[model samples]
Target: MSSQSRKKWTGYAITSAIIISLMIITIGIYSFEEENLKNIITKNQVEIQEIITKSISKNISSELELITFELALLAESGQLQDDLGTKESNQLISQTFDRLNSISPTAQILALDKDFKVLSQASKIHNSFVGATVKGLPDLIDSEENKTKSESKILSINTSLFDEPEIAITFPIVNKETNISNGLLLVTLPSSEFFKRHGNIYDVESQFLMVMDENNVLLIHPNMENVGKNFFDDEIQHDISYNSALNEYITHVLEGNLSTVIVTLEDNIGERINSAIPVTVNGKNEFVFGVVTPTQSINQEIDEIIFLTKIQTVFLLMSTIAVLLVFMLKRSQSFKKEKLTVIGQLSSNIAHDIRNPLGTIKNAGVIIEKENNSQNKIISREINRINLSVRRISHQIEEVLNYVRTTPMILKQHSISQTIQEAVDTLDVPPDIKINIPNNDVSIRIDHEKMLIVFVNIVLNAIQSIGKNEGNVTISIRETFSNVTIEFENSGPNIPAKDLKHIFDTLFTTKLEGTGLGLSSCKNIIEQHKGTIHVVTNPVMFSIKLPNEHSNTE
Candidate 1:
């Protein structure tokens, strides 16, 4: 009786122990699965959020480009340069700027001299910006060619009439005669209010997009109260802990060491992902784009995944998956390097890599032409073809770089007839061809260097089309109160009707050696000047009609 009772009790004890062990193991498995799941989801969300952030950056850049373009058109339309510093010109320019579709009503649009003294400003708050000295803008006028691409700026944290910080976008006014920047057409808006107007990122769920300065102050935020929120203030307490990683991130931001990154932090809802990228202005980090988004939804997904699985044994999996997990973690880390950095590096590297060999090939062709001076038909023709091929490659390189290097037009007043004559003077015109200069000159505002390029390209094309034949390229200019028309009448054979329609189309060309970019670039330059270009077949004339914009100043 005693042995039987003891055996039954032993059996109950062992079964209870087994049940306890199973429960403990199940809890461990679920906990491990949740960690891994959140990691995977965080990585995916980081990529998507990074893409979203870049889009915001691009939209910012696009906004600047738009405002800059509008200012350029004002000059091209005969409005700004001549009467600068005059109240009427200021009123006209400011009024036009205020009406532009891209900026918010609170934006400040202004014109300033090279000394940073404001000539005029348009604003909803006050007209005080007209006489204020723009304290913090980098000297864009005398900077090297590389720095010219940067047209964006963030004015000092100094408060304005609206009691908000400012972000400025400028288009330089260059004096063509002296090749110096004379003034700038600028548009600025309250930094905090700027992001609210961007349709993509205003109020999306629990996500917050912000701009912070090196002083740890949030210069821009969707909430006006958050605009001055500083990360380092000891008197203020935040819902989220702002120690360790955050302070480190601030250091990285102030150091201007990062382009893009996703910062992980402990949140009330388990965890959150926040990213920040420096807004580079004139080669320095003036502000940062900080994106904060929650990761709590990912935990719910993990719970559902674990609950839905009926039969799952993951005990052996954890032991063997360490290396694979490490690899994945590394791959995720690599994504932090971001898209812009990669693409910019790749394109520049490819250009350099391609051009080095092209130069070698060009040098080799020259050596071949000189070393083997045989006048035999095959050798002579082969050398000629080699030279032509070298030229073609060189032209192709220029075309690609031109696309990469193209910047917004800088408008200045110049004479159309003089520009044409200057272009013709640079060319090695054949003895049989006559380039006739017109007696009448027309003054128009334009980007002189770009116009010079346009004129040179068109005249070169005409000369090449004439080849060895005797021909006339008669230049004519006619001006009216509103517009100026310049024509080039060449004796070359009539261009095919089919080609005439597509003449200005990008990458449209009939020549075996042409890059097809010359005419398209010319067309772009003309359009940028608020002008139009067209070709006629009868005399193969290319005509350009530009707005009669003029400036009467030194």
Candidate 2:
């Protein structure tokens, strides 16, 4: 392939590679950021769930101990030695019950007979419990001595008067004088009451509090209907157990172990993190208190961080691309300018070396043609052709030298009409080619010597393009407020559109004898004078615009 074609394809490949590389880098960054954000959010959620679980369990445990403290104090005070089923004893016990009930209305204080039958009860829900039997109680009298060391023993009880599961504490009652057991005192309270009170006391929102018995039966929940339900026996919605891995994790929770796990649920609640903690009853790990809350709250701050990170990433990428583009563009221009400088230096050296030798050769050819006699007619004719060839080479070398010349412009106010006429006088004009210039004088800022070179090249090119045919070269000057435009239009055969586009490119030409630098040199000269030159091919014309001398506007 040609050098030009190779350069074009190489540029295309480099551009494509840069674009693909940028895309890959952007996608890789996005994926890495997304995964990192997810990991951070998941870790934060686990920590929050564990913290909430511990806080809730500690609060509930302390509250339950307060009730235990009250009961223990009463039992150790020696105030319950009266006979059973007596009116006076009932009145005395009723007064104590009223005092305890005033402190915590949710609690029901009762006196029980030896047969585990309730004798007198003071409660908010049940009006009377004169002779009701309590079910789901262990035979505490059998191991009375072993359990009696402590005033209160925790147990679960279900009675006809209760709505859901209840936590019952049993203590043996003794006479202060004889030290003998007379009856048992029990304090029963709904497990739901503790959960509800916890919600009101604390400011935890969107959290579901639950308490379950050792048998895996749910004793308390935010939802009232869920109370007294067995998690293992009842059907649950969106249970994580469908997945074996999740079920294994849940197994730890059911075994009364402190565990935090993520679970999905229906009803717009979406995903949640569950934290369960074990509570001891009857000196055994027999209850689990859990807090269930949505994961959104845990990740709310993380979401904002991720959003800002993505925006910053995009902004940084765009800024980097813009900076890279600007750097590349400036570098390309610098490289081109450096190349042109080197070519100019080299051309000046070569032109100086070749011009002297060519001048000597031309003189020799001229002497041979002038001194040859009629007998050496063939020799003289050949010498004439040699001189012509030498002249052609000199002209070609001169064109190259002109193309590389980098001279600073010497600005002066000059008459446009006079400059055009002087350029025309220097050109080898044919009589058949009619040339016309405006008589009016228009002043413009220009380098007069360089302007002469520009007009001469354009006029010569026009004449040569017309060949041996009759053509008119008309010069029309159009002056605007800020610019003076001179157009050289010729009636020559039009140049091809494809060729016109590159008419001023270095080393580009359509003529066989052309050095391809004539028009290019003209363009350089015009641009040095802070002017512009362009061409149109319909009738083969060149237009030049220079800044008006009297105009201050740019």
lDDT (tens digit, per residue) of candidate 2 on 316-363: 477355434433553465466445544544454445456546756776
lDDT of 1 by residue, 28-75 (tens): 755675577667767766775665555455445444444555666655
Model number with the top TM-score = 2
Candidate 1: count of backbone clashes, pairs at least 3 residues apart or interchain: 0
Candidate 1, residue 288: how far the Cα is off, in Å: 1.6
Q: Lowest summed lDDT over 10 consecutive residues: which window, candidate 1? A: 198-207
lDDT of each: 0.64, 0.67
TM-score, one value per model: 0.44, 0.45
Q: For candidate 2, list the clashing residue pairs, or say none.
A: none
TM-score of 2: 0.45
